[model samples]
Target chain A: MHLSEPYLSRRALLSSVTGGTLLLTLGACISGGQEPSPTGPDPIEPVLAASVYLADRYTAAMAAVPDLADRLTPLRDAHQAHITALTRELGTVDDGILPSGRPPAVAPAGSESTPAATASSGNAAAPEVTASPVPLPAERPAILADLQGLERSGRQQAAALCLAGSRYRAALLGSIAAARASHAEVLT
Target chain B: MTTGDEQLAEALRAEHAAIFGYGAIGAKLDKATAQFALQAEEEHRERRDALLLRLSQRGGTPPAADPVYTLPVAVTDQASALQLAVTIEERVAARWRSVLPQAAGEDRTMALDALIGSAVLATQARRHAGISPATVPFPGAPA
Candidate 1:
């Protein structure tokens, strides 16, 4: 039950970590996660943001197409895992759920009917993939095409980021990108 | 060889094994799946050839393919064949995933292509084998 002196806030911890990493990466500015300096954006932010955006897309899709639940929910859960990994790397806290503002239109009926997406998850204890029972009846083809497009763009973005990232980061980004590419193939 | 070159060699080895594995898989499959296996084999051949050239251009004697490989599962019937197919794709995907961190430019691009390709193929094979949630969160990452 021991802790840092003066109960230093989480921001202080994050700042020191970012500052140390920035020294090697930037070699100039000695800023950290707290102080907004001229380092543009945290490189992790873009991929992290992309994962959040992709999760939202999944939420919308699941809400709009209930029958595709069995299909789409697992992909969405993968994004959740991606978000967890990225956030963990950034030294940020995440409960490992969908990131959003407004509440979901339809809440999950239950996790009982859902399946785990562990075939890809590195975390053995990763959460179960869940879905809602929304009554919307969209055309399956159109919905699928839209999802395929989302996955293609997401994959490309992550792939580009992977190329520019550090060795460790590259592996993480590459895996996430590969998942999206597979998603596109599945949708096709 | 540098790390990237080593990774390339490892991935190439996987490609070679996959080409051989698919042959075993195809023999037990029906016409539809046999055609599918042939296409996958062809793709692996192209990759293996490309990697062989890359290693040679780096001024080293590229390693020759193994005379044979011991498959993890027996391929005596359709069910086992499909299982072997999934197993091959999974192993190939794992090899490609290892290459991403070391690879650059053309190597990186090809690694990504192979990783994604194996992942997609794995899903299809899983579906054919009747595995649910055929898709994965991170295709090439360790389970």
Candidate 2:
């Protein structure tokens, strides 16, 4: 039985045949298989790097307080998952993982000179402290709240990263974003 | 109303909401967690600023944030609060996807990545909650 070219009209068939030949010629013209373009650092790399640093902090916390290990293990794993997914997509990873080299001495909420200082330094300045810097809260509720907040922040950063890297690596960024969102929920 | 500018405006709105949500989430967190939340908030602020700059560069006015944003639910417990956070990120991802059609190359890639990342995060959260369908079928692709 002969199959009819219903899908491919005469003009379409001619174009396809021509296209195929052109593709073959083009392939032969190039010596090596199309070399992957030298990709620059993806915009989302910094955020993923930050997440890895945060994951390390969580791991440290878990180690320090064995009781919190169960609570933080999955979160830590998720961050690791994100780093893997992002790095794989970017084809490179940044050496630095921390979100800025040094931790803030104080919060940015109640600082007078902090804005000016940050502007001059071109980095976030440590804000003044009105509230006392007590030790980490002991209560479960307080601790959970903190964890939830941290996860939310991580999710936001991931989301931004996804936005920044969506076009070149949709699948990778999507996976990372989803993981961050999941972390937020788990922390809550 | 649904011009490129409008799409950008919607994205900016999502950024504002995210920044505000981080504040609520930060309140209950510990030192390390609080620091992360604060940094995330700052990042969103920076992105919002960049959006405004882009808009102005194109001779368009950037959208303003509302006086207050309404939360999907009260963040009374960690579980509920995290659920809300997940939802917010997903919503933002959806909005970014909308803007993707108009964007190209790097910008488009950025939007796609953001959407996917948000979806992955949401899935992780769901699994933590012991829920089925932890990850969505396609996090940032067209529905």
Candidate 3:
């Protein structure tokens, strides 16, 4: 995949030529006040869950296949950083769906599996999401490709959110989208 | 607050420099890699040209590209050429990332698109350079 063409950039470029004006027109219609038009179930929470989901998936893949541990850890840590940065914007994560997905300021790298309640939202317990929303494949190469797929999908989702989110959050969303896009390249 | 046009002009400036940097970079690379380098340079040129039109349409004066830009590294060989490529893409990405927070509509779309393009190219350049990890946690973020 070293010489592979960028999967999303091509589509993004084409859409940007046409979508930019249309997106603003649509935004103008619904944007009665300062809040951006809703694109997902929630503003930033879904992005939060998605990052937690990715971080947990990374932890699972690392534990399930030890050979990839060295390569996967940093990618996992990136998701953790995404969580902290996003939660900072959302204030406190009392959304109920994710609980204390927000770490107590900074959770150590290894704390992804703390599996204990933290004071913020008791949602740190969700870290032990050993059983993910998407099940893992037991095979070796399959799991790597599987994780790569997750990164790619997550990248697309984040990119969409980044486009629709507020200008205040655009930078963070764009960074997360870019990070996930890069993570897929590293998976192999 | 930085205006979107200001950021766009800055990114256009970065794109101008990237096109200039790629010329030196391509000279040091092999035929196959140089072809890749040419494509990268072409993309920057396209972006620079587009941003030029965009800024004019918005009634802003686009900055002129310098006749020559100071190379970040002396590209004596392929390794240094690749290093310069990475450096250019990172600078380009940082410029577009700055646009994201300030621009909206088509401008923001262009910013996001260009930012991702720069990030992807940077990863490819890093991989070609044999840099480990080959990807960044945040593409435009300062090291």
Candidate 4:
């Protein structure tokens, strides 16, 4: 549904009213010695896992849709870039390392089984681990939706990572957020 | 209710809802749209799993998904679907905001960035839907 005109106007009015105050509050919050939280092991590992997962999915998508291969190639490249960047950052951090609790069971590519079957096999290896589903759609709209979702998810994970990391990590996450924001705009 | 675990549960709940919402979103669009839906669904799945892992690591049982969730509005068309997406992102952003107080350091920055990113995505969705005031005044303001 469309935003009601009144609602839009009210939002604008409210923003105008509180804009300065919010900025000042944020500034104070930043200036105050409220040092950012340390990166905890529980949070960082999943984000890294997600980055790797997306990169793999993108590779699969590119292979499945040769027609959109040229278009999607850059997107896949971008995800790989993110994976590298996040891995490096995580390497430097002290907390939030995913426990060697269990290795993620990844199936061999192009095996006799269907992608879904392979994914299921992998899942069986690590019963507690849940991953994004395999067997994606090859259509452009479907692909775009998946990409947007991936970017949005990445933004969330990056935000979490930023919170758990240091100033450098936060800045890195902010940049990632900017990229995801752009992805949302272009993917649509 | 505002404990770290509780707040994380809420965030995971929102992720579950968003994942479910993508099903409807995927149905309304063509192949191009399906791609976006597929990716979004995967992302939600990953986030949900991560949240579950986090809860388990803390010795808490992960929350289960609700049998159904109430959408803010019907999503019969592209515009409406995007609106729902904007709403989902905003809600998740709110959860991040709540978690910020309880979190420090990297977690705090991450939450702030997530909030900002959600706000940006919501604004983009609005603009794509041809809505006026394309930019939301506040990205993660309540409701």
lDDT of 1 by residue, B74-116 (tens): 8889989999999999899999999988887789888888887
Q: Which stretches of candidate 3 lie over 4 Å from their true place?
A: A1-42, A93-133
Q: After superposition, how far is residue B62 of candidate 3 from its true place, in Å?
A: 2.4
Residue-level lDDT tens digits of model 2 in B1-143? 33756777778889888878866776665564455456656666776787778778778778788878888868876566566666776777788767765565455555555555555545644554455546543354444
Cα-based TM-score, every candidate: 0.75, 0.42, 0.78, 0.44
- The global C-alpha lDDT for each of the candidates, from Candidate 1 onward, is 0.67, 0.51, 0.70, 0.53
Off by over 4 Å in 1: A1-38, A94-138
**Model 4: per-residue Cα lDDT over A1-188, one tens digit each:** 12122222222232232222322332233342223335323233344444445555666777777676655555555554554555455453232122211112232322323222233333333321223234466686887787676666555555545554544444445545445555555556
| Two-chain DockQ for model 4 | 0.07
Looking at candidate 3, what is the lDDT of residue B87? Answer: 92
Q: Highest lDDT: which candidate? A: 3
A-chain TM-score per prediction? 0.56, 0.49, 0.64, 0.54
lDDT for residue A37 in candidate 1, whole number 0-100: 24
**Model 3 residue B139 lDDT?**
83
In angstroms, give how far residue A103 of model 1 lies from its true place: 17
TM-score of chain B of each: 0.96, 0.77, 0.95, 0.81
Residue A152 of candidate 3: its Cα lDDT? 75
* CAPRI grade of model 1: medium
**What C-alpha RMSD does candidate 1 show over the true interface residues after superposing them?**
1.3
The second chain of candidate 2 has a TM-score of 0.77
Q: Between 1 and 4, whose TM-score is larger? A: 1
Better of 3 and 4 by DockQ: 3
After superposition, which runs of candidate 4 have C-alpha atoms over 4 Å from their true positions? Answer: A1-188
